[model samples]
Target: MIESRVLTQDVFEDLARHARRVEEAPWLEFVHGKLEVKARPDGNRGQIIAWLTRLCLQAYPDRWLHAYQGLRTETDGEGNARPDAVLAPIDTFVGQGEWASPDDVLMVVEVTSYDEDTDRRDRVEKPRAYAETGIPVYLLIDRDSCEVKVHSEPDGVRYEQVVTVPYGKTVTLPDPVGIELDTEPLKNWTR
Candidate 1:
């Protein structure tokens, strides 16, 4: 067997310290006790995120749709989540302060391309976190499995409702944006 690289607690403390230094720092998700750094979505992942953002823009000309590694949410100390696509109310996101928080997010979207376990993380763990923080909608796009999961209705620690859609179907945002994405384009997103 190969050797392992273990990250000590000090490293996470250092990262947290660094995280506070930058303006609009990259977002990171904490799983287990370790940290997973966030990176911009790759070309294939970016394609779908971009398309969906465009669809959101067309759907709600007033608000804003942001994607990739910059959105922040509170789940823990410095709790930041860089969802693939996040919808924010224009009123809260004018130009300063906190553009988006857990409560301000109308929807948080994740498009999975690689990482099998990461897919599951978004499915169960992140949904719970989002619900705990009272985000209205959690949209998950499983490109590999050709599935879409919509988690709404924050109940206790987890969202009470889970609606799943397959490739042929479309997942709709109930209100706010009131739009639909033809999830078929995401059916064959293989990395």
Candidate 2:
């Protein structure tokens, strides 16, 4: 039996191999040199996501709405990361063709956990990737701070405008989906 000492090349090769071979591993992802297999979020987060999805779908019945949690997002040729919540067009998500590319993503909502580092990554890194791929809207719900930021006006490689929706405020979205999000339900979110 041979136990080989690991090398960077070996590790990179292993990661590359994993990316190459697709599996039914519940949407595993690699972010910042970490192989993260995400289980579903906890009770509070799940409740919020579910409520939001339900309301949004009800508001716009004709539109293609989805409530996908932690779908693999390929950032580069070999890197695959997953966002917390994604709302994409129904056509692409149905697997009618290839997996939904970043451009197909209509809106992305990230419910920040207690981890500031991960929140920072969601705030800083993901906007760049989404903007680069031309995803129109990126909405972030910060549970810790009790704030929401609606990112828009994609300029070059980043979102130029960030509309801040403070806690206990009814937030209004842009045209087409001109529905105002009531923050009343979220008041008891921390409990």
Candidate 3:
């Protein structure tokens, strides 16, 4: 339980860099002033990301889905998050440091993992953090529930609209990201 009051952003960034250098250190995130350990993806999870990458590329060759891109999710720079994937125009991240600004991001994606804290971290915290940062969309692929949640229309405090659909159904990711996902393939990636 490392408290935010005790850890400056610079120190946390240094610690995060050190963890990256170590072999197999757990992925880390700083949200709501607390340090959190992100669960590593399993093989099935990896496949889902790969599939998404293919779909995204076929839809828009000018955009890219950057995996594990760390972001500064708060205006004050206190909250940092490493989204599973980020959708942006090609070259949007050029020369940006480890923590990139979310300004040009079209959408952020989080695929739920089989971990205890996932419900709170992915479902609750991430949506609020990304919305507060004024991100256009927050997409949640919930394997446990076999559903996909698309969060959009950020009004600063939270996303005003959230549409949820069961796996195998089609979901459109709204403008700024105008991609329609036929979620039938997602069923094959779940547990």
What ranges in model 3 sit over 4 Å off?
Answer: none
Per-residue lDDT of model 2, residues 1-191, tens digit only: 11123323236436545654765444445443345443446688778888777877777765444554333343452334456666654555665222245556667777676654555466776676666555667778887778888887666478887888877898876543456888778767754
How far out, in Å, is residue 175 in model 2? 4.3
Kindly list the per-residue Cα lDDT of model 3 for residues 52-141, writing each as its tens digit: 888888999999999889999876768889999999998988899789989899999999999999999999998999999999999999
Model 3 TM-score, 2 decimals? 0.97
By TM-score, the candidates rank as 3, 1, 2
Worst 10 residues of 2 by lDDT: 1-10
Clashing pairs for predicted structure model 2, backbone only: none
Query: Model 1 reaches what TM-score against the true structure?
Result: 0.75
Candidate 3 minimal-lDDT segment of 10 residues: 71-80
Candidate 1 lDDT at 160 equals 83
Off by over 4 Å in 2: 1-40, 69-79, 96-99, 175-177
Cα lDDT tens digits for candidate 1, 6-103: 54334544664577588877545554344665544678788877777778778777667776433444454244455777787556555633323455
The best candidate in terms of lDDT: 3
Residue 14 of model 1, lDDT score: 62
Residue 51 CA displacement from its true place in model 2, Å: 1.1
